[model samples]
Target: MLKVPDHQVAGHQAGHGHPGPLIDDSGRFYKPLQDDDRGAIEAAFYTSFSSNTRVPDHIRRFFPVFYGTKLLASDGSGQWPHLVLEDVVSGLSHPSVMDVKIGSRTWYPEASEDYIQRCFMKDRKTSSLDLGFRISGLQLYESEESGLWKPDRKLVQHLSADEVRVVLKKFVSSNSPIDPNLNPDCSFASSVYGGSSGILAQLLELKSWFEDQTIYHLNSCSVLMVYDKKKELKGESSDAKVKLIDFAHVTEGNGIIDHNFVGGTLLFDKVHLRYSYQS
Candidate 1:
């Protein structure tokens, strides 16, 4: 286990090397959920998704891999924010089901993806075309009464066309390569795509043909805003609220396939939103 400064010593300067009174001077303490903690978290997260049969057949193929270490120091309540793949996935999953139980219950195939199929009218009518995938988008929120973090059940809603426009516009306009939509670019997408997603924002436009709804895109982004439960507006409470996880990629150039070195897991077969457009 690696040692980091205690809470008192880690204070304001903990994340950085800045010296200040808020620095926890209690000698070196272990970073909460360091590399050693990753295995547990990964297993926990993977298991949660694996066990849940509700996950779509296509998505289950790409396993969730949690990057970085789970460093656990102490929170004031004697609890450390448990960092793990399961926690993150669970955070996105549980609240999603509670709000929108994807599949047939909420959204149907024709009502969703606008993409047209290649099969002739006769084939389309007879063939069992399974546009089976569904996306349950959710946002992580701070709990007021618990004082501990819990998924705010009310945050689920259909992605508005305007909101989608904003995310895409920001992604294309931002100077950073990292699609600020998702919290952190996945290791697979980054590893396979290339570039430092954590740094250096670059601008790119959406490749058309991908605006269909059949493909369930799950992406996250880091929230640069200040954290305040009271200030946050919920989905039901406000239509202007944004998904704080990460930025969704916006493609350009007639919306055709365009490739760039990206980070994190990109399961090209199913989840490749880079170029494949339906309809």
Candidate 2:
């Protein structure tokens, strides 16, 4: 929530302003949060995991762990906007990141109905993709030596080599039939989450067929780049590791598209350009 002057917003929209918690000179991010529904939600989640819908389980795996919520008092706005959350990446060793806007963008000052429809669609898709971060950061690999479209050499990923290999081995060794329609591994790899944008025409199509979900956050700037080798020093658990940071504009919806009209999907290539992937 850094003070955004009247004009410095993206596409001239105040809502599009820095969508995450504000970071001051010291790298501290102030996030506003709330959780009165936790008990009810947790009770419902226990049953949801066993359901065929599979949304709860998917959320548990890929969504950032709720380290609990905090209540805050308002100082300036005159109204008590008690919604404050601790920025997920506030204390990571080296935090750098990017986000993928799932649907279309209408960055103009006043968004049109079509743009609003697409933006809502993006929110739904994002909530589903919250599970993407859970698949394992090991599936993603970025080198420290800077290059085009490269995530920061020291950027943190959801999976590590050790973590992903275990999952990969299980999948490869499994005798069970892997459903081609629901192959999240391949689909996520081709997603903005996995960071590849080479052949999007097909990938976007694949996204529609499989790996459709939501993560809540809406802005493309919600992604974080956090890399800390010695992050867990004192009995710290992996669950607290900050994956994505912002959750300002969250929504849920199910929309279908005949073609891949995703305008501002943040592919890794768009973030960093490597020699091999560069055109």
Candidate 3:
């Protein structure tokens, strides 16, 4: 467990030293997730994929390796917001951190603040995917023939998770889920070729529930991937785990469920954008 001051705490003047980035793109946290709120997050990582299945550690990012909070003694300054967070993926050699955030730019940031909170705050009614506005992507599937993952050169592409999810949802909703229109980057294609469908099925579930969220990322959110070299060398079935980040622009209730705001399916077809695998 690492104690970090929230990103908002920067330049506020403090007695403690700044624990800078563990790796590049590492952000600080001045606010804690509260002791009571910790359980849900942990569960989100460990047991939250599907209500019925817990993904194996080799391929799953169910929570950080270490997660918890510690109260710091006040130094007569301001309310110290040092937060406890899991080392989301900075422990590996030359590891890759890929942020996979869900939602659209227009709807996420454009939504009013009141609506954003009400919609994003997950109660028992919301699925875990919608709660965090994130989903695991099909990052692992690449091609030697016409695809992205070559023996060299890692990739970090930009595309909306909203576009990916909605397009996939519409595709799977039809009689033929794996049709020609489906993007090769869609996890469905890989699931058909490989097995461990439990993961793909869970992702499909994420797509099905995409409409439930009223808010989404306006500026953009990231779905990050972390690499495990030792695991791969040992021939662990999986080598990476993915998680989401950058909630600065996340909004709530921008698009009502009835409207399916921003016409995601329509946008998906228009964009027709999916990139290659990373290193």
Candidate 4:
């Protein structure tokens, strides 16, 4: 891609004096927490997505499934470093948006113009969420023998609208760390990612429980803001406690493509036009 200083971005290797987040003992970033296996996953992805992407051997070997939005950073040093994230707000119309509060001070640098420029705009007012541009998730478990957290059985379960709201409230209100136990029921076990499905499908599968319900769209520009966690659930230690993450997609005349696009977009436009004509 576009050649620029790495320090100004999120996930790049700035050789030295970089003050951004560092990899922990488990080989994951501490903040915006991500698993350690992401490095290689990202490298392979970059290589395939673009001819110019350079995947560092060390990073590729270290992280197997780096999820979320990646950017470059300088870390106050001259060296450019990569900023691997767990979840970052990035799509077609917006920059990689970071929600941060630095001890009462919040810093959110504008998303890269280079990255944002790459996204396809649908028209003057609308833009497509870059389908090629991706975030990360687990693909396969390291091993069942290891028995910690493997991607082998990645599944997505749907929650009712009310259940989804509860999950969102749990995530947004809590200060506790991410609990792997926070997930849907056994019904969703079948729809997890596989060789046949795309990331969007995997994400959609995760929310299949809320079918036929009106999923409220709180923020059209950013999906990250839609999920909120419960503040009270923090002190407990239970996987069944039910934490919520936002999975807002497939709106009328919106970012993603689905089977309904052709029918839905036209119908929505007609209905709107009819109403406007009447008004």
lDDT, candidate 1, equals 0.24
Score candidate 4 by lDDT. Answer: 0.25
Show how many residue pairs clash in every candidate, following the order shown: 66, 32, 23, 52
lDDT of 1 by residue, 191-251 (tens): 1222332111111111121233223232211111111222222312111111112112211
Candidate 4 residue-wise lDDT, 92-207, digit = tens: 11111111000110111132454334322311111112111111121111122332121211110122224322332222222221345654221211121111241123223323
Model 2 whole-model lDDT (C-alpha atoms): 0.29
Q: What's every prediction's RMSD, in angstroms?
A: 18.2, 14.8, 12.7, 19.2
| Better by lDDT, candidate 4 or 3 | 3
lDDT of candidate 3 over 82-179, digit per residue (tens): 33444554334333222333432223435578745654552112222332333323222122232222121111122234444443332212122234
Error in Å for residue 83 of model 4: 13
Give the CA lDDT, 0 to 100, for residue 279 in model 2.
Answer: 16
How does each model score on lDDT?
0.24, 0.29, 0.33, 0.25
Q: Give residue 90's lDDT in candidate 4 (0 to 100).
A: 20
